[model samples]
Target: MDERTRADVERAEAALVEHYPHLVRLAHLVLPPSMGRHRKVLTAHGLVQRALPWRAARRAAGALPAQRGPDTAAGYDLVRQRTLELALAYEDRRRPAVLLPTVPFVWGLRLFPRAGGADELALDQALSAVPAAVRAALGLWQLEGLEPEAARAVLARAGVADPDAALRAAGQLDRRTGAGAAALLAAGEFDPCTVHVRPTDLLRRRQRARAAAALAAVLAAGAVVAALPGGQPAARPAPTAAQQALDPGRLLRTPNEEWVRTSRVDFTAWPPRGRQAGDRRLLGRALRVWAAPPPGTRIVAAAGTSTRPPAEPPRLLYAGLIDNVMVVVFHDGERLVRYAEPEGATPTLHFARTDNADLATAGALVIGRGNGWQRYLIAPWVAGVAVRDLLAPDAPPHGLHLAPDGVTDRIPLPPAGGGPCGHWPATELRTSARLESHPAVLVTDLGDLAPVHLAYAAAPAGPAAPGEANGAPALHSWARTACTLRSLRGTGVRSVSNWVYARQPLPEGGGTAEWVCNRAETWRGPGRAMVQFEPPAAGPADPGRIAGRATGTAVCGPYGRGVLGGVRWQAESGTWYLLAAGGGRVDGIDVTGGVRAGADAPTLAVPAARDAPAEVTGRLPDGGTVRALQP
Candidate 1:
């Protein structure tokens, strides 16, 4: 090499060494705290060393004019950009492929703790919850002092189309936190210094794999190495069932035992001649039956950047459990739509696009849980179109006026029972179908476990007799029993309100009246609940006059929709009545499972491959008329 070139390289190397500590600190802020400090430092070192502009300056020596003469500011911005890129890649690779379907709707500043009160743990969860591109955009603009357009360019490099929107959202999130990004670095109640640093060979992992492969090849080729005396390796033992169960990769694919046969609904039967275009019941049933897998299968859902051309690669449109069935829908680029019923192992064609406009631009609607998630073709054309025209195959599609502020097609669904089906209230649909589209599947621990009946034998010598006027004591005993049951079943109890003074609705023409005691709780997996006291005799309902062991549990399904059943004590009537109210909003008519008049009701089963729905008998202690549920 020429003397001038060699000198330039040396100068660049010296500058890099001097700036190394600052670069590492910058990387630490941009990357997840889950990655240990050692790796962060190493990754930062590498990024700085590889920055193209910096590298060019080093190699070309006197080719580029010096900025600020030997100041670290020279090419520092370029180094920061490169560091941001590396940090983004690092975060993307670490994110789990499967995500809870509720994330998009639940997305808000609540996911992040206030930056002023932030610690490593809160920051980690917040970062994991948000899109990596959004996080990177925030890092570039806020931490690296890059301009909005410059940050957008960096985001564009990472395949984010609407960088401005992403940045705006990030800014809003930051503002909502009422704290700057530095809050994540601030020491709070928890000491950041004491954090356990796990050693990782991230940069060398690939090299290690390659070396292992080469060694295996050598050993297969009959190569042997001399070993010192007593240097023999210890024998490794096989993994036990428990160890296998704990393996993180084990649930990537559904277990064979978890597969169940699914029921099918013919497509031709839907949209009855007089049915409205947006019938909520039809929409719910159609999506549920179309997208749901067999009763027992758990769903495995994933979404990310895709290279499939012409239109964007398909993304997860919906993932949820409808009536305990796993349903998943895809926002696909492919013009052909397909459905797979339990009886059919392979998906058959459902809809084929023949319109001049691209169907890829508009997103799809979804209903159901887990493997039962079904997608609704809300918009078949890029331009906005009316629902009736979009659904009619013979009608020419009309142009839709796309909203300017990110909100696109507003496809309204028919309100069944006075409410939209499946509790999905979002009407403003936006397009996130490109490679940047992030799709997620919701998988709960309660696959399809039918809600188990939890009962407590009346405790002796409590504040009041089990059948006495004081209901709090008996309800309290039942609640403890329920808590124990919850613990044994291994389900998480998100929240519980016990024995609070709330009104319980009496059967028949009774108006709302205050109750002496009530209990409720939100649960994870399959069921959530609300507990109320019921009076035995019908007529003017009186909470104060209510007697006997008359407590009923309103069990909710995965998405806060569920059935109201269990024993209702009516002291006045002295006769037991079996009651079952449909699952879903009490105000809405879209009932999932309900019992009217003495008719037989279906058990609440979580669609499980092997577990059948738990049988339940909603027997009330004598008297009072049973309420009929509206479909």
Candidate 2:
């Protein structure tokens, strides 16, 4: 073989056939997940298949990566190099690699790599956090059994700018993970060869097919029309462009009386109410910069939100000086885009999807946040505003000065998260139409388009029932639950609801204690919930610790009418008691493991050894069983 020539065509094909599974697995591991699961699987296969020697160019080779295993043919190395290069290119940010198989789609029934254990999940998540180059290097080193230098050389050949730094980062990841990269990789997590098959939604599949056919017909007609005459398409500004090319005059405007006239009370009905609402220059700059932000501008979109230009001419929500910075909000049916420009500072833009949002979740927007204080652009129907600390239930809510523009004065926010529970303050909005004021609704910011509505369930209400935050018990119930919100910061949460499922009479006359579930729902589909057991205390601030917490669960959501939670409590005499309680839906309770006990009622109290592990199971009225929430 010529030193310059990478590999012979016949030899390369043979080598690829012999090691097809390994190559596909490596490609799958290297490809970024931004393309989504099905696309990633298909793209990985396509990359391997297209890596034939005669068809693909040789990867840059100052020095070839070290060969491992029994077969060390240069043909294997050639295909491997090409596959790595293509896989790196397939990652987000660089360019498209159109090596998709042209034959029948393999994923007509949604195909995905087989699910792995916890270690594999952690490894996959860790890989997702790093650059594609780093992930490639790690995959080569661990899955391919290559030396560190060999992996670095391969990464450099594949056009990774800083291969040495990538190798170093890969090393750091290996150390940080709970298990070794090699051990985790051996779990078949990145194996595209072995996969799980699930059918796509049949109805959605049919709808998509019709939609695609219609789109193709439209495109064909458009092409024919464009070729015949002066049928130039309209020029739309590129969203990520660094220059302000979009005309600001195209921005949409609405009358101030639109709120009263429109039947909708959400963002659509929000009228322009800022002092700078009529400032054409400021509004123009804002719109232009949003379409084409400058180099220094910072852009952030919440999870599950789109990173695209406005689908429609965005209607003005509010435009004014908020906390000394000019802030502008726009709603275009899908999302709420906010643009803020501080004096002598580069502009900052934010986007959050408001899909499926009702008036309760979209009532208020946090326009400005800084210095432990936040300013809100409230709904026009909101006649007055007040601030109250959830932890301080006895304290009266102090009225906040609401400007005619519907922007509230800078109000102090809740205490910072990740600390011991303290004051949890919230904005209280009052509607003007109702003379007998409705129960005060407390809304708190969780870094989204709208503040998350806080719901609480007090006594006399069922486990599934929730009410507004006005009573003393509701405040105390929330105080125990508010500390968990700190974990939800920047998670694009839509709402945080608390429902008291059951009250258990503590063993040895420890008095009545409440069990509540605080669940945080996010716009990104998945949500987390925590069940806490609150002991009877003299004051509202006496917090209860978390009994159980879980992710990807609807333990306290609409569907989960029943919730079971347990706490190992020590009575005044220092005897340990396993106390468990369930909502109304639970007909009986069962205690397993060290403390074996059963209760005909919803509540269970059993004497148990100190620090003994036990599982609490609840039997529902309908004969369905429910386990206690787990971390």
RMSD in order of candidates: 20.2, 12.0
For candidate 2, give the lDDT of residue 86: 83
Per-candidate clashes, comma-separated: 30, 0
Per-residue alpha-carbon lDDT of model 1 for 242-341, expressed as tens digits? Answer: 3343332331222221212212111111111111222334334323333332222222221112211112223233333333233333323332222223
lDDT of each structure? 0.34, 0.76
Q: Model 2: runs farther than 4 Å from truth?
A: 1-250, 434-437, 459-465
| Superposition error at 104 for model 1 (Å) | 36
Best by TM-score: 2
How far residue 501's Cα lies from its native spot in candidate 1, in Å, is 12
